[model samples]
Target: MYGRGGWARRIERRLAWSDSFVIVVVMVGAHAARFGWDPLAAVAGPSATPYWQVSVSVAVLWALQLGWARSREPRVLGHGPKEFQRVLIASWRTFAIVAIVGFLTQWQISRGYLLFALPLGAVVLVVYRAAWRKLIHAQRDRGDLLAQVLVAGPARTSEQMIRRLQRNRRAGYNVIGACVPGGSRARKTPLLEGVRVAGSLEDTAEVAMSLGAEYVLLSGSDAMSLREARQLGWELEGTGIGLIVAPALVDVAGPRVSMTPVEGLPLIHVEAPQFTGSQRVAKEIFDRASALAFLFVGGIPMLVIAAAIRLSSPGPALFRQVRVGRDHQLFTMYKFRSMYVDAEERLALLAGQSDGNGVLFKMHDDPRVTRIGRVLRRFSLDELPQLLNVLKGDMSMVGPRPPLPREVEQWDERVSRRQLVKPGVTGLWQVSGRSDLSWDEAVRLDLYYTENWSLASDAVIVLRTLGAIFFGRGAY
Candidate 1:
């Protein structure tokens, strides 16, 4: 297969060049025909002012603005709002320059011409981009526009990179094969299905060239020397191929990755994960403001839930459990009781029937779950009390998963690091797969968040959490 990104970049450059030419010609023609040329001739007679010069200047400036805004950046071409933003920026910058020139020279610029030209150019640009994006998206829908990437790294890292690319197709990567730097001892050419081992890391560049790969994705901690890697970049520099570096750090959220150039080396600094701090302060402020507003708004529903629980079961409406929080502090986490009062007492009998992963106990259909409790858990009404906990600073709107002391005690050294920040009512695990996640996977996600938290990441998690709660996947 062809290398990843090669085809995509080629298409982007072709479209950009063609579109740029068209936009420039149309802008120049529109402005001169609509306003400048006739008026300049009317004022200057046959002597003629330099109208063509001004028109050419405007066209050139428009083109330069497009380039400056990187309206043609391959990575952002077919998705997100960045592409549109760039187009708008380019058009507005060109318009501003025109306005400035008219003011400075005291030129009789027609208001109708300026108004019509700006909007028309913007509309044409957006239309062309939208059409091109649609075409590219259609190609992706048919799995035709993908760039076949060659992943070079150790066996495991290569495998992980391949899987990650396969999972996120919108990123436009297609992992065709892998090259293990040290070479694998396996007799088979490929350790995984559909992935052939092209060569060792020492020959990574050669493999990429031979395969006509569009992109080279690098992984591994020690496969290639820095000198060899630099040489590989130099070899691929003019080859129209792209190089991507994938670090060994797994599950790192994007905002946490920051590059600081210390001397000549680009050192990556990962910030510690905390949902509170400034983000928490902001969240808390929102939560308190919201909770107070919601208590009045949601008070009726809260009362209804309480009444339903009281009438359905012969017990209190709320249940509080001892949960570990930030700094390993113990707090009583309140929730609408979803299990009978004797659920904990009955845990000993259900030991053999435990459905949870070793440490955490769960049963898909527990005998202790009250009828009303089942409904409460299904829609996550049980979590509403935690909003109060959030208001009180005992929990957050988003963070790592809160763990029980027993579960915390069973954690290995790395897992215990989750306590470095406050726990959340809803977190990465809650939004990811919830009860469906294995203990290991859940711990991994929570720790991943604990090690790389951000307000934006928290917002994304909370947004996803809302969807998960609505879908009720793995919630029971």
Candidate 2:
């Protein structure tokens, strides 16, 4: 626990140094470009303020704004989009203030200098933070620099929380022990394989202190009242220990969740999912534009693959199949032919030999795949034709997986929610594990994306998809 705090402080210091360096470089560069290197001679009109002095002041204020924005806060440092968003907001606000001040004081600040420095500094700062985060994530993956947590809840809820924390190592939570309602009496009993009962919920703070825990996570099923929770919070005050209440909401993004205090009680507000808006229009525009651009750039390679398929297989170069799209609309999905002409007929014989999760049919060595087709599938070159689907408005660059018609037939209402968004050529499930994911896990990822779709998230998925294809992760 102490180590985690030290690590966070180390990261903060590094970020501060990086931010200062970037600000100095950008400001100095902008000043030199706008005015000559002679600092004393580069004076503003009327005010006679030296441009170098203005540069120094702006640099100092930019650094201060980053701190004021809480961009270096431990809670947001190592994960999620909040850290980057905060940094950007802080930088923007600082510039806005500078502009307003310049106008009122008639300082005659160089617009070119301001414009150049602002964007360059922001980009450099964000890149520096991302590099630091990557290093931290690498450390955490090896079980270092993680917060030691004591979970206090019902056995079932505690178990679930432990599993989730274990699965997402990047979240940086390491569950050391659990304290249930009657955990004191079962101190020797194991809650999960390695996790043990630390103490009862009443002794949560004590248990956490004894275990050197940095956080006490309370599950929704914990038998503690709000008053008791408050008392626990008070007890742990000044101990460098924090309390986390695990709400029942699952698969929700941070931007959609808000906390409001009413009558001294904290109330959580979850915004309803939105499917149609200007954002949707923006996404559609992006998809079509990107699809058209990629199609043009990839035309030569796609034609080469088409020729290879023609020579290796007896069937057509392109294969078209029916897939269920957004709002349960059926569309003709296109792919390069990867299977033998009789592969569909052979499915009946190989039905019992499937290595895939129950819904999707997959085989590691299906014998039906042509030699060229194997290479195409491994690198996802077979899906190049989907660019046309994206251009035609039948798909997106990133969204839920395109489901087969037969698979949709077995979906319950919860699973069917994936149809709320357009299908994608590559998505969370594709980059995450592809064929390695079970049907339930795939559905969960798809549903999560359906509910929390954003252009930024889509951009992230697109970048990850390229890496996944290059490495052939979970590809047969």
Which structure among the candidates has the greatest TM-score? 2
At residue 48, candidate 1 shows an lDDT of 31
Q: Please give each candidate's TM-score.
A: 0.66, 0.86
Q: Tell me which residue pairs clash in candidate 1.
A: 3-213, 3-214, 4-147, 4-148, 4-214, 4-215, 181-201, 276-280
Please give the distance, in angstroms, between residue 58's alpha carbon in candidate 1 and its true position after superposition: 21
User: Cα deviation in Å at residue 368, candidate 2?
Assistant: 5.2
Q: For model 1, what is the alpha-carbon lDDT of residue 148?
A: 68
Candidate 2: where are CA atoms >4 Å away? 1-5, 25-45, 48-55, 105-115, 293-317, 336-355, 362-382, 459-476
The digit string of per-residue lDDT tens for model 2 on 99-211 reads: 89888887778788888888777878877787787788789989987888999988888898898888777788899999998887999699997889989988999989989
- Model 1, 233-302: lDDT tens digits are 8888877778888866777755677989887667888765545467656766765676677567888899
The most accurate candidate by lDDT is 2
